[model samples]
Target: MRRFNLKLYLIFILVLLVRISNAHQETIRVGFIESPPLIYNKDEKLVGALVDYLNDILPNFNIKFVKTPLSRVPDLLDKDVIQIFPMYFYSAERADKVHYIPTSFHALNPCLCALKENKIPSTIRDPKSFEQKTIVHLRGTLKNRDFLNFKNTNYLELPTQDYYEKSLKMLKLKRAEYAYFADFQQVKRFLNNKKHSNIHCENSHYPKDEMFFVTNKNFYLKKNLELKISKTSFKTYLKKHLSRVNWQVD
Candidate 1:
């Protein structure tokens, strides 16, 4: 009986050590972009709604965040250089490379901004009405697919400089009659500038798209995240975070 008791005690100690080692294992690296109020760097620290949400909910999870240019996220995910990415919408090409969490983390409302000096209509009610009207947008992006179908609208695609302010500046400069498509919050932030007061953003016409998290297919936390997010508090936290952007959770 004494020998049997000794073996059990050793087995228990070994199991406890193994569990502790696993618990303290290397932190998972999460990649994000500077889509503020969603995720962005401020004062050299990662700060934003998503950052706050993760901080609040994942106390037990070991996570290390990495901020990079939003443009590079796709390639980085493909190479599995980053284990996880947050707040991205589903695309067929992305789907091919990464596995998405089953639930949408939040939604975004993309809007169009036009300069008041140009007498551009406040809203784009009819696609056909865009004929001959010049629309400026960030180069390498074609987010407004429905509006693009009306090829009659002249496009002045501009290169991005890690921000959308330049695209709005072009509209202010009258380089284009209107600038089309950005997250409503981004447009609001741009127009808040005194110089951009001449710009009017049309929130009436926009697309409401759901955003999700993507991870390398082999990421260990992929399954665990699905479980964590299903909790009531997780969704409540998400709703609270998005509320800052005037987004409602259904």
Candidate 2:
């Protein structure tokens, strides 16, 4: 009886040791860009809706954040360097690389943006009317890809710019006749310039599409753990900032 009791005590101590070892482990890492209001970097610190959300809900989990270009979110997630990024459109090529989180939005309402001076057709209502307008677009963005293959348009397509807002400014400044934009909040921020630049969203625009997170197929194999973190963290993010006016698209 004494021998049996000693064995049980050893097993309990071993179990406790394992648990402690796991507890000391570091948290999973994540990445994002400096898109203001959505994701922003201030004084070398990252703060925004996404960051704030993680701060509130991911405390229980171990996480490290890496700041990078928005263009890299899908690659990082695929590499498993970070856990999530917000406000991205779904594509077949991306689908081949990672699993996407189901969300309310896929693509944003994109429109034809033009300098106040461009002569837009009264008949212009869709992509078809962009026949002769010199346009600025971004690489890897839906707008760029959608317009690149155009055999119909007679105008020139400008090189992809670093920022979408900057591209719009380029269009307004006569660098191009038009530049299309999708993210409303970002667009609003760009247009708020006191210069009161003459740019307008066409009365006829494309329908809004879906945007959501793509799981890094390579990095995240623990579905249960990721799902747990994703659910709570995203909810906390929305709960805290969703009510703020800055988040609205209209």
Candidate RMSDs in order: 8.0, 8.5
Best-fitting candidate, measured by TM-score? 1
TM-score of each: 0.71, 0.66
Q: In candidate 2, what are the lDDT values of residues 65-162, reduced to their tens digit?
A: 77645567667776667766655677777777766665432245565667667755444335675665566654445543455455666444333334
Stretches of candidate 1 off by over 4 Å are 1-25, 69-71, 118-127, 138-144, 154-162, 193-195, 232-250
Least well predicted 10-residue stretch by lDDT in candidate 2: 241-250
Superposed model 2: Cα runs more than 4 Å off: 1-25, 69-75, 104-107, 119-128, 143-148, 152-165, 218-250
The TM-score of candidate 2 is 0.66
**Candidate 1 weakest ten by summed lDDT:** 241-250
In model 2, which residue pairs have backbone atoms overlapping below 3 Å?
Answer: 27-62, 27-63, 105-210, 105-211, 106-209, 106-210, 106-211, 107-209, 107-210
Cand. 1 TM to true fold: 0.71
Score residue 7 of candidate 2 by CA lDDT.
100
**Candidate lDDT values, in order:** 0.67, 0.58
Candidate that would win on lDDT: 1
